[model samples]
Target: MTEPLIERCGLRYLHVVGRNFLVWRKLMYASMLGNMADPMIYLVGLGFGLGGFMPAIEGMRYINFLAGGMLCYSAMNSATFEALYSAFSRLKIQRTWEGIMHAPMTAADVVLGEWIWAALKATLSGAAMLIAMYLLGLVHGLRPLAVMPVVLLIGLAFSGLGLIMTALAKSYEFFIFYFTLVITPMMFLSGVFYPRSALPPVVQAIGAVLPLTHGADLARGLTLGTPMAHPLLDVLVLAGYATCGVSVSVLLIRRRLLK
Candidate 1:
């Protein structure tokens, strides 16, 4: 393909997002009942419930901390779920990826389109959750607005990784290992409910390796109105993750589909 056409292929990824709009809209409505409920329970349970005992983080309310972490969680959940479940389904059962490749699009285009869509969906879902948190007064200043781009970067990074995982995944059951071993651990150890400094030295080192740790730190700093430190490092690491993820995902799709 020509350079312009290849670039356009990336743009078609937006159509991939548009195509799924209705289905996600319906799903989001259904998810809202559950998504909204879980955050509310957490905000209440920890913010006011356990918050009575635990002091605020950095002098900010506990709920605010909880809200920021949860917002990041929501975006991560959305991106990872879509990339893993839906992408796997299309690649395996539905053969949607294969079908797309038969069109003017190549395997690279198919993977790129799907990953981009997943990122967009994840961003929308996460943003909705953030707005809900804001309405509840759990969110802090407009600094939290910085979260939008961060959410996009995190989602894009995870979407590529999710694609790579889906490509390698043999069954839905395989996801169990990923969520249990990797995702769950990162969720807790990434300084969600507490500070990373609270952990032991070795564990803190492990936390630093996880992208969620940096993502959470960035989100928390913005939401709580704290000064950003080494902001470029955070961006660079997340960008590195995205680059590796996209490279692997493209390679996998080409190997799987074009072969």
Candidate 2:
């Protein structure tokens, strides 16, 4: 029988994480190169090309404003890509999860490991954007250091949500609907390219409930050295998403991978 829920995600999950890391290390350079490309383009292309036309937002340059949202966006995309594509390969295409299962572990162990690994890897994406912002002179002082924790939290939030999607996907093509329907809309609504304040009231209401909204607000606040309206509440919302997403995904994946 499978272990109890709490017992399932024990310290042994780290073993799965270590195994994935070894596999990933071989492709680390190529992986980082690919991951850095899009965000860098957005940072430079949009930040300068478009930002020049936009006026100061809430007293900060448009580029500075966009950088914060980009940080959260980068983290979110990184975690989602890892959790969905990489985890699915291990789950279905390669049968890596099966091998790990025979390593004397529960499905929850594998799920949690992937969850944490996605989050960990996502921080690299977030860090890349942050460093770019620094080099471009968009961030200043010690404030950017505060953005790392927010990046990790964004990673955890998206990773959990992505795993939930992965658990239910029947084929690789199934992921297209999610990216197009969910991530794309979220990117627009969560204020990545512009402030949500400029959106219609109805759209604003919907965006407020998304995890990226809170994450963007937190990251933006930290990057710009501004006060977060409700730091505790925003964090609680993100943590809630991560908690529920992982819990539900564990249940779903366990049922999906029958022994």
Candidate 3:
């Protein structure tokens, strides 16, 4: 009989995190720059280019509004990329997970550790975006610092989701479907580029169910100092996703590896 997921996991996962951290440290500057650069380009190019023409969004500058979207988007992209490509490399290309499992760990521990490592990386990207926005005067006040926690949650939520996709993926080619069908649509429809209301009602219904929508809503409200109708609901939805991702991915990965 297989071991329970809970029983198979322990503090040893931290060692996995530490291992990834040490590897990351060697190229920290390059990795950090990669995380920050792409989003900064979006913030600067679009904020200055397109935002210059548009009027304030709900009394906030267009760039300020864009900054909020970029914040969550940065976390989402960073976590997804790390969970998918980097994690896949470790799992498939490098066979890192197999080697790790030889130690006193299980598949669940590997999944948990990889998910966490990806989340932490994504959080760093979000922090970079937050600080950049602060320097650019896009976010203000002590309250905006609270966005970091939300950013971390966004990281966990998306990275977990990414792992689910990773578990199902047969090859790196499989990822194109996820990015094209899921990530790209969520990026546009989650109010990252504009208000959710701007989308059609049918589309709004679709976006409402996605994790990114809740995440962007939280990011926008907190960063732009605006009120949200259901902040608690948004947080719950993301937490639910993170939970589901961990649960489902563990089961699937166990099947993939052990069965």
Residue 151, candidate 3: C-alpha displacement in angstroms:
0.8
TM-score of 3: 0.97
Can you give the TM-score per candidate against the true fold?
Answer: 0.90, 0.97, 0.97
Candidates' lDDT values, in order? 0.77, 0.90, 0.90
Clashing pairs in 2: none
Distance from true location, Cα of 219 in model 1, Å: 0.8
Model 3, span 1-259: residue lDDT tens: 8766678326987888999999999999999999999999999999989999998887788888888999999999999999999999898899899899888788888888988999999899999999999899877788888888888888998888899999999899999999999999999999998888988999999999999899988888887779888999999999999889878887887777776
Residue pairs in collision within model 1: none
Candidate 1, residue 257: Cα displacement in angstroms equals 1.6
lDDT of 2 by residue, 1-259 (tens): 7556666326988998899899889999998987788898988898899999999988888888888988888899999999999999999999999888887788888899999999999999999988898899988888678979878888998999999999999989999999999999999999888889999999999999999999999998888887789988889999999999898998999989864
Candidate maximizing TM-score: 3
Segments in model 3 whose C-alpha atoms lie over 4 Å from true places: none
lDDT of 1 by residue, 1-259 (tens): 2222244424655555665676668777776565456655776687778777877787777777777787777777888888899889888988877777676666667777778877776677668767877888766577678788888888888888888888888889988888998888988888888877889999999998787777777877776676767777887887788789888988876777655
lDDT for residue 90 in candidate 1, whole number 0-100: 84
Error of 1 at 134 (Å): 1.6
